[model samples]
Target: MVRGDPIDRRLRTLVLLGLLLGLAGCAGGAHRLPYDSWRLGLFAPNYMEVWIETADAVDVQDRVFRRAMNGVAAINTPKNLKGDPRGWPTRSGAGAGKQVLGADLPRLVYVRWQSLAEPQTYEAYIVIPEATRRAMVKPETGYCPARGIWREDYRDMLTVGLAPGGIARVWLMGGCLSAIDVVRVQGTVVKKGPYGGKSGGQHRPLSATSKAYIEKYGIPYGSW
Candidate 1:
């Protein structure tokens, strides 16, 4: 009921194809991997965390960051969702200055962008079934900003289907970190499909810079 018939059919076909092609081992192996392995790259349970950067380098003064943050905050607020944490970063010095005051921050700072192109400005997360380690996608999650950290709370979920190796690949669109993680995790944004679908929705072909970045980062082909 949660997923559409078309996607389920595609997954079944893919499973059958993999079995027929003698890729059952690969498929089985990926399936058998502990949920934590899939979540955190073979790390200990609860050790998985992903840091995504924008596709284009957003300047501290970019309007896109401000606008996107505003959108996110609107989605997060109790008036909407009644989230606890408050105030996302802005192009103005206020957010930047606030970030500077944080402890143990990353050396590379993230500035806002001029544009958060359609699909580029999405959120994502993961979920694990009780008997299985495979994390499935959920319908929606709450977006809460607490003490400057962004958190996705997986209250409900819906997942996208791709091959096992898909989650390993992260896309870096340009010099900036514009990439999408192809896995299901708590608080992750739903970027694809009708309900969460973008207005423009389609991605323009990658530019040379984007290609180079993807290559340099060793993005898994499944990521695209």
Candidate 2:
């Protein structure tokens, strides 16, 4: 497999840029950012450290993921029977509404991001776990490319699809999301794939079910 640019870098930049927009517009100005060829840059990042909190707003602590935010290692599960994989499939939080296949299987997710343009400031999110580290480590496109622009799709901060890298991917969602789904998020920024060997758009569209949820709840998700 041909190697591509690091996925982490693009993610770092996108995260920073996204936060930049939030910071710049928090006082309520809305506009667009100029440069748009999304790809990995040379900006060394600080891994936007955040306090991962649970559904009830309890902070999540760990030896790895929440702390390290790195690694592809596994932990021994509740029961370890011979041939029984003591692990769960990946999925999102119950608070994010119904479970989603391939979503990060964490109690909750927190985000911290910085960009070269806005180095001094950082933005954070205490949203549902939407992705996994492996999805970043290995993309079908090999390198992490700038997949889309962070724009508003309805009232939500949507990462609109721009293009696709010509490789098929299997996002190894951990926990209850073990069996990789047909689609996955590349980072916190955008969604990807058709599983197996098919190429897909940059992000998945809001399904009719999702629209219904939005109509009832006013937002696709609830966050703090």
Candidate 3:
């Protein structure tokens, strides 16, 4: 085959074009981000029960990005408080959780809830730090697995705590049942409502075990 032959030149051009196309495909894939799944958990102290109304994602400018929950009728504290961190109640139903893509990562989470201790609906905008979001995509390693199974579910756990007088707390679950405090957003009364309704419920005394747990560890905020 001659160096400048028409047939040789044609083959070289086709090979170069194929290489360029392959490179372009790789670049596109690198920029594309994978979807991350998340579930909501809650912590309420002093036998306080909280009813979650809405938990939505907002952008930096406070624009609604995604509505995670809307009047889902879910409780923060479970009926049976066993004093075990793992036994805490997380919001159930299809809307209690969300799957977010990288491009749609929320800068803040707007949460609204009603507590039996207050006669009004309380709302707050919880910030999701850029570091936490980045960690979500690339979770830390070196943590031992549970029973020989590496649990990836911790990366998807987001817990919210409610206290009397419109106090709120937020945390992102870390590996090995660790809770990393994201921030505490003080709740503000958004609207007035009847003291007793869907948000109202019969108060029950904390179990002996749960009382002891709280006595020792204080209110289970981000820890569980």
lDDT (Cα, tens digit) per residue for candidate 3, span 155-220: 556666666566766767644445566677677876444222443543323445544544555544
Worst 10 residues of 1 by lDDT: 38-47
For all candidates, the clash counts are 23, 10, 0
Best by lDDT: 3
TM-score of 1: 0.19
Window of ten residues with lowest summed lDDT in model 2: 37-46
lDDT of 3 at 179: 59
- State residue 220's C-alpha deviation in candidate 1, in Å: 9.2
Residue 41 of model 3 has an lDDT of 52
Cα lDDT for residue 84, candidate 2? 19
TM-score, predicted candidate 2 vs. hidden true structure: 0.18
How well does model 1 score by local distance difference test? 0.21
Put down candidate 2 lDDT per residue, 1-224, tens digits, no spaces. 11213224323443344344342222232122221211110111011111111111111111012221211111121211112111222331111111221221222222222211111212223322324322322323222124333321111111111011111112222121122332322323212221111334222233343234334434211111
Instruction: Give the per-residue lDDT digits (tens) of candidate 1, residues 12-95.
Output: 443343235442232212222211111111110010111222211111111111111111101111223222221211111111
